[model samples]
Target: MQAVLRAACRAAADLLFPRNCVHCAGPVETGSYQYLCPACTRALQFCEPPACKTCGYPYFGSVIAPRECPHCAELEPVFDKGKTLFLAKGPGRSLLHALKYHQGFYILKDLTRMLKETPHFKEFLSGAILVPVPLHPTKLRERGFNQSEHLAHTLLQNSDARAVEPLLLRSEFTHSQTHLDRKDRLQNVKNAFALSATANLMNDTYYILVDDVFTTGSTLNACARTLRTAGVTHLRAVAIGHG
Candidate 1:
């Protein structure tokens, strides 16, 4: 009965609002939940094996054994491991821009669905709590929502993760890292995050940090350092893309 009621409500919503593709803003087919049209969906490139063991960045060459990428080797990441769903290019990049800057909440449903299908998403998040990389109050007000928090919540729908907890807070507002070099990017986020006063830290609990993209991984690393300082011993991260 509840299922039938939900179907009726969904049908009514389609009639009223009419769902549109989050990627291209085209009309979605009736009863279709794919937030992207078939063309855009096909354009999404899922990260496959032969990636860096530490950061999960896809490797271009053949692989006989798992290895850390040069970046991971040079400066170790604070998190135990990291995973991402897609390469940060083409449709994946456009989708992220739309969702982050254009109020594309509809993309969450399909994005989470894809994240759930990633190779190690389930295994990595199996016994963890979700901790979204936070935005400063100023940025939060401007954007109206934290994309990472939404991603964490959507992922929670299919995982055994305990809950989505915004335990971390941005202590300082920083410039955007979009065009910054690795050194500058790391410097930009330095001392930018801190554990919230209301947070309860469980030393034994695994916390999975969530984010929209991993570029130099500076932001995520900074967040991990703060968590570690606050006595969090086990950490992992998942992102929508590896830029």
Candidate 2:
């Protein structure tokens, strides 16, 4: 009875102030939480075809071959495989910025919706424990919350998958690698992570490390290296976007 009453109150409130779409800023007639108008959502370049099988990065034109991109082929990723919901263009970029910089927690629902409905990622979740890449303590303090953690939780909650936050730790705070080249980025984060001493990882367990974006992939590689060393046999990853 209380739950029904609360839902009724929320419905009435939504009727009073219909939520606007996040992408187009138009009135949502259905009083829903979707941030994009249907038309705008269609206009966005959803990562459909020509996507790399290993990382799910949408490739334009005819050039790349199977199982890899120029980026991933040159140097293999530490993680065994990866996939993404969107190709990190159009509304993808804007929504990610909102989630990271503007505290757009509401985007979690939309992001998770995309993840859950993607057929490529649906049954591929077996043996996968969702793990969010960790932010350094200082960065976490400044940001007030880890955006990657929010994304990971969304994946877990929507997919009914087990999520573990205790498997990785930032051993020491390192300088941000936003401006660094790939080599320097890798070096900057070297020795920056350690497997939690209390982590009870089974040798056969598979983990899917989550993050907001995949740039140089140096950070995820480091985390995957640590997990591999800790006896984890199968590792996969997914990011909100692939830069």
Candidate 3:
């Protein structure tokens, strides 16, 4: 049977290339769908309610109502809204580091699965085009592949979004925003992105910028600004973790 052959192929592949858990790097248990080990799964801090409505940053206050955070309030972001699947800590942090530095391409499958389970994911992506925040040609060459682009492709597999469109192009190669403060982060990415010359952005079309992390949000904001300037009105973002 076709199913039997598929199973046998999977078994052979497993034998040839043993899989490891994305979080713990331990040998994956047979038939386990999640990339994380049981311990790492339990350690993940899923973003919950009372988060910022605009950015989806989780809050731990006793207050019951959800509201915008000061960062969102002070300087309104170009994107309409954003959401992150988990707080960038604990197992989530470790997994992010692996995916960014190491060739953890396999982790995208489990991450997309987790993102599908997030509250409002369907509504968030409805009628939207997935856009991966692009990397400069030099950086892309050095990294081999863009992690954001891979994440966007994984998300598109299950969503009805139009497509994973590389509409935004990085114009300048700036320093990594990793250790930069908020102000410096903003400056580093300023004018760093531009809409592709051949991009055909529809009027009133929604765009969801995809990225790996949402630390200060400067990178996403820059991408959003470029899209907005290109006449994109409905803009938002989604990421794996909220740093």
lDDT of 3 at 170: 94
Which lDDT value does model 3 have at 2? Answer: 100
Say which candidate scores most in lDDT: 1
Candidate 3: residue 27 lDDT (0-100):
71
lDDT by residue (1-243, candidate 1, tens digit) is 999999999889878977676667787764324676777677777777667755678887787776668656654789898887787787788778878988887777777677656736666678799999999999999999999998888888877789899999999999888788888988899899999989998988999999999877889999999999998899988887877
The TM-score of candidate 3 is: 0.88
Query: With candidate 3 superimposed using the best TM-score fit, by how many Å does residue 232's alpha carbon deviate from the native?
Result: 1.3
lDDT of 2 by residue, 1-243 (tens): 999999999789879987677666787665323776666576555555567655667787786455457656644677888776675666677778889998999888777667656756655565478888888788889999989888887777767466656578888898878789888988888788898778888766678888888777788888888898888888887887777
> How well is each residue in 146-225 modelled by candidate 3, as lDDT tens digits?
99988888778767777889998999999888788888988999899988888998886888999989888888889999
Deviating ranges (above 4 Å) for candidate 1 = 1-19, 25-27, 30-33, 67-73
What is the alpha-carbon lDDT for the whole of candidate 1? 0.82
Enumerate clash totals for all models, in the order shown. Answer: 0, 1, 0
Q: Estimated TM-score per prediction?
A: 0.87, 0.84, 0.88
- Please report how far candidate 3 places residue 160 from its true position, in Å: 1.9
Please report how far candidate 2 places residue 167 from its true position, in Å: 1.0
Taken over the whole model, the C-alpha lDDT of each candidate is: 0.82, 0.76, 0.81
